[model samples]
Target: MRISMWVVATFLLAAVSLEAQARALTQNQQSVCRWGSDIAAGAQASKLSGVSLYGARKKLQVRKFPRPWMRMTALGITEQTYNSASRLKPAAVKQTYYEQCVRHELARR
Candidate 1:
């Protein structure tokens, strides 16, 4: 009886933890999506001004937005990084990678 109770308690705890993790992951994903969108917008603006990916990355560094935002922005600066890894390769490949990375981060969240 005691063993059965322990097992039940453990299962409940595990279930609760899983729920918390899922919620946290959702929040992280949303945050990433927002940040990625912001970074992409910024990159697009830079591109209009004839800024290269390397230059854009430097510009984003100067802005220093925030975590995930900053990271995503930096990620948006490297065209090669996006081309090598991302399967989708959106027109704005750098920005797409930034967004995908955000999504990936969320999935792991």
Candidate 2:
């Protein structure tokens, strides 16, 4: 009985893990994620380049990134994330963006 219970538990865990891993971002989603992610990354990284958060957003708008202002609104990066992570090194910022974008997209499904 103990062995059977353990096996069942293990099987259930495996199934749930596989299901979570199975959902993938579509091609368009990959593109959109990259677009938004890069924009956010550039904005955040700009602090090192001497740009303020507000300045970065305006520059992005003048350069025509979709919803530059709204990226901090609901359904996107929180202001806390934008503010706190402003000084992350470029590589770390990129990984952070990729993970956040992936998690958000997956949860939307």
Candidate 3:
């Protein structure tokens, strides 16, 4: 009986640990998605205002860029201007934007 109780206790602890890990992973993924979306929007917006990526980065700061996801979309529409001017690929730029957004959001929290 004692052996059975010990096994059950161990199983419960393992299950709890697994649950915690899963929750943490889910939160991390959600954060990444949110950040990427924000960066893309910001990039698009900057493009619309005739701001080069370098100029925007300098002016807004990567973390302070506004409506990042929307900006990214705008860039997508005007690929020639941004693509020719920026050193980064669109996806890479978007990821960097997202990372910055995530950091800023976390700092705010």
Candidate 4:
């Protein structure tokens, strides 16, 4: 009985691990993740160019360069811009955005 229980537990654990590994982002999810990364980069660019967060947002809107996910990411970056301390780095922000977008996409699926 003990051996059988151990075998079943191992099998269930392996199945769960395989299912997680098998999951991959779809094209749409990839696009959203890319957009999120882009938004974060854009924030860094705006900072480097001496543009305010509001100005950067306006430029993006005028160019119509971002999707909904990008807009959301940008908004978060903009909020960070106002805070003098604890300002998020562009790469860190990008990673966060990408993860969130991927998770949201996965949940939708």
RMSD of each: 12.3, 8.2, 13.7, 9.0
- TM-scores for all candidates: the values are 0.41, 0.58, 0.35, 0.54
| lDDT (C-alpha) at residue 17 in model 3 | 60
Q: What is the lDDT of residue 35 in candidate 4?
A: 70
Q: List the residue pairs that clash in candidate 1.
A: none
TM-score result, candidate 2: 0.58
How much is 21 displaced in model 1, in angstroms? 17
Report the error of model 4 at residue 61, Å. 2.4
| Residue range 36-63, candidate 4, lDDT tens digits | 6776666765676678867877776666
- Which prediction has more favorable TM-score, 3 or 4? 4
Candidate 4 regions exceeding 4 Å error are 1-23, 44-50, 66-86
Best candidate, TM-score = 2
Candidate order by lDDT, decreasing, is 4, 2, 1, 3
Which of candidates 2 and 4 reaches a greater lDDT? 4
Please, what is the whole-model Cα lDDT of each candidate in the order they appear? Answer: 0.56, 0.61, 0.55, 0.65
Candidate 1 lDDT over residue span 74-96, tens digit each: 56444444234333323465445
Candidate 2 lDDT tens digits, 1-109: 9999999999899757644543477877676666666655665567667776566666644553455554444223423445673567766676567667767878898
Off by over 4 Å in 2: 1-23, 66-82
